[model samples]
Target: MLAGFAADLVVALHFAFILFVVAGGLLALRWPRLAWVHLPLVAWGAGIELIGWVCPLTPLENVLRRAAGQAGYAGGFIDHYLTPLIYPPGLTREHQLALGLFVTIVNVVIYGMIALRRCRLRQRSRGEVARS
Candidate 1:
């Protein structure tokens, strides 16, 4: 019972991590310090997708499930659940590449916006200094 609960917890945490990797850049816009945490996560997430690496969490979850006397699943939760939802035809290497690119593009856009905003603020401050 405890093992099953642990496995479930791992699955939930894994899902949350995925969400953070996907959307964390927006959080960085509000709290710049969060970028430190989010950037590495983004890189790891993209690397996993691009390189087709199995996340360690997948095996850990499966082990827990097996210890609990439950049949372990073959793939990660994304492979079992999200892939089906997003790609009815099923997840292919092309889809994985697209997913990785999507993450990279999204983060790049968000960070670019943040940089542009900072530059504008700096320019406005300089203009005020000049006026004074």
Candidate 2:
């Protein structure tokens, strides 16, 4: 039972990590310092998808489940849980690549907008200083 509970906690943490990977750039826009933390996560998340690397969490969770006398699952979290809800079919390599591409595109757009806004603010502040 204790192992099962630990496995559940791992699952929750894994899901939260996925959410952070997907949308954490938005948070970084509000807190620029967070980029140092978020960028590495983005890279790891995208690499996992693009390179087809299994997350270590998968095996850890599986071991926990097995220790609890439950049958360990065979694949990553997305393959077991998310695929059913989102894809209704098996997750293929192309789909994984697409997910990586999607993450890259989203962060690019978010950071691009942040850069544009900062540039405009700098220009506006300079104009005000000149007028003063």
Candidate 3:
């Protein structure tokens, strides 16, 4: 029972991490310091997809599930949870590449917006200083 609960907790944490990897830049837009944390996570998440590496959490979750007498799932967390919703059957190398690219592109756009906003703010401050 405890193992099953731990497995559920891991799954929830895994899902939350994935969500943060994809959309955490929006959080950084609100709390600029969060970018320091989100940026590394973005890299790790995209790298895992790009390189076809299984996340460590997947194994941890599987082990916990097995300890709980549950059958463990095949493939990574994305394959077990997300691929069904986002992609068709049989996730291929190409699909993985696409997922990685999608993640990168999304974060690029978000960070680009952040940079533009900062630039504008800097310019505004400069203008104010010049006027003063």
The candidate maximizing lDDT is: 3
Residues 64-98 of candidate 3 have per-residue lDDT tens digits of 98998888444556447753443347989888888
lDDT of each: 0.83, 0.81, 0.84
lDDT of 1 by residue, 59-106 (tens): 888898999888844456644775344334777889888989999999
Extract clashing residue pairs from model 2: none
Q: How close is each model in CA RMSD to the real structure? A: 3.7, 3.8, 3.8
Q: Please say which candidate is ahead in lDDT: 1 or 3.
A: 3
Q: CA shift at 88, candidate 1, in angstroms?
A: 8.5
Q: List the residue pairs that clash in candidate 1.
A: none
TM-score of each: 0.85, 0.84, 0.87
lDDT of 2 by residue, 3-31 (tens): 87787777777777878888998998899
The CA root-mean-square deviation of candidate 1, after full C-alpha superposition on the true structure, stands at 3.7
The lDDT of model 2 is 0.81
After superposing candidate 1 on the true structure, give the runs of residues whose Cα lies further than 4 Å from its correct spot.
Answer: 72-89
- Quality of model 3 by C-alpha lDDT: 0.84
